[model samples]
Target: MSEHLFSALRRWPDIEAPNLFAVDASDRLILDEAESQLADIQPGELVIMGDNYGALTLGAAALHGCTGIRVFQDSLVGELALASNAGDLADRYRTHTLDRALLADARLVLLQLPRSLAELDEWAQAIARFAAPDVTVIAGGRIKHMTLAMNEVLVRSFDVVNVGRARQKSRTLTAMGARRSLERPRYPATSVLREPEIPVVELAVSAHGGAFAGATLDIGTRFLLTFLPEMKSDAASAIDLGSGTGVLAASLALARPDLHVVAIDQSTAAVASTRETANANGVGARIDAFREDALTERPTASADLIVCNPPFHSGATVHAAVALRMLADARRVLKPGGELWVVFNTYLGYRDYLNRTVGPTRQAGRNSKFTVAVSVRA
Candidate 1:
């Protein structure tokens, strides 16, 4: 067997640590490591907090150690389950915001560094407040993105911070100490004009610390908007699967008032941004914003049309699981006669997945780096 598989097996046991809380269990690396790191721990209950990924909970089961494990994740539990193998594990999973729970009793806390510095600060403050003085807080990320300054924030927030040698282009920061109370930073909101060719409604946007293009409209979204189809009156329901800042959703609502638009994303900030965009455009009544894993919990056979410009990467890793999940969910949620519309870089091979999942996929539009596909359910 490959060394990677051996390492994965070795790391699977560490996830059973009693009272564990992992912030972002992206691909289950830290959760697997936690299980391996504490293989000898006696049977005991475990609790894990994650956004949408429940890798930590699965890690606990793979080790066959935890008396029981509970998971708190966002609304995308269905999507998280899509990529996880923990279907029958002895555990409880709930969909809720991580901030809703207190973490004072957690013995170990693992945080996967997020893309936004503001989110990092928020997580740091939450850890400092809930973690005990001796509790170990480990933050890990790819070495290229993890900086001395980021380490300094951990050090300043906790009592001490130590860096581990890089492995697999990843490094871990070990920190100890009770955090002090500090004022949370307030993020500013901004509004920008859409490209001249696109019609504008009310479009004010406020990004939290970690939003992609929190300060401006991304070129990809601009391209997506320009290519959006003119909605037919029969479009009763539509979904913006990765409706970042609600740009696509807002535009869809403005263009098709008869269609109830549901905008979904995995980030809290993205959800908030979408809601804000809807309200600013006076189309709040027509839009529903929720923080959800686009891969997991789409309305089953609920949408007549689905639109997405799926993100290619999470943080720095070019993981396609997210995009893959999105495609699967779109297939499941679209009515038998519904349509799925997506824009992706031409080289990403999205058509192959669409062909297999949605059937008879074809290019609806194209550009230098992107190809828009419209797949109709057979």
Candidate 2:
């Protein structure tokens, strides 16, 4: 059953690389294992979270005849994949954000483990607070990703926790005895980075659990910010594509009052954090933080400048497809002569692609680890 569904899956619109695959051994193991452990769960009782593509959600609905399954994914790409692949089973499941309504009364939750301990903690906390007292939670991921710290995180939310034996380099962790639900959810933690060591000082960074580097100044972003003074000064508008916590957007607005910045991220938590970071930094009025897929809705040649520190990975796989797509889309959104300022790992060789897709590319700055480039839109 698992093999049948796995073979039918595709990671459309997502980068298809030889090193990256839509389905994996872990996905197969999780579904089969969850089905056996949750054999008696009612159709609506099973909930799926963090499924890459539609494996967990579609598998349960299509193969197990489960109905009314609720699912939540942080990536906009992942959400679209599940919808596109729903086929005739679309009616059996629904997609949601990490919300109280989704988790309320859910008894059996199947999950793909997140890399961030904070993200895992956030999920565990939500399930503990929103799920039924009798709820049983089973989370799975690649063996390399599983850590003793994960078990420790779940123990805070559940009284009963067990780690399953590894199968095909994958494993699942089970939990029960949920801690009492919270009266309200408070997450996407905030931290204030204040130091004379960095140019962007006293900036309050807030990140939703999935946001990269969790509100801290990632080295790549910090490296890019070094070239902020060179950005178009007379520009009326700017965009920060794939803006995680609105770090670049907020910084731009605060640095230049004349520039109205739009910080776009696909994650709801990221949108909230961007707004929070903006508000905290007294630049919220100048920044419009949006939860969106790339800049698909923006008009062509709409911007004076854009900035990005694109992620090279989609989920667990290391690949450049996401960056390539973002760059291509960035070119569509930039006005002729408008520049897309990007800082990436020095080894990625993104300069060649930028020249082909966006326009003439020039290295704005480079350090030991990162290369910042300016790509003008043709």
Residue-level lDDT of model 2, residues 1-378, one tens digit each, is 667777778887677766567777777777777776556777678889898998888888876778889998988888888888888988998888898878999999999999888888888999999888899888999999789999999998899999888998999899999989555554778889864424466889888787878879888888888788898878889999888887888888878878899888777667888999999998888999887777887888889999999989778877777788777787788887798999999999999999998899999888899999998887
Candidate 1 residues 175-195, lDDT tens each? 777566665544435676556
Q: What local distance difference test score does each model get?
A: 0.63, 0.85
Clashes of each: 9, 1
* Model 2's TM-score against the true structure: 0.95
Query: Which residue pairs in model 2 clash with each other?
Result: 129-181
Per-candidate TM-scores read 0.69, 0.95
Least well predicted 10-residue stretch by lDDT in candidate 2:
193-202
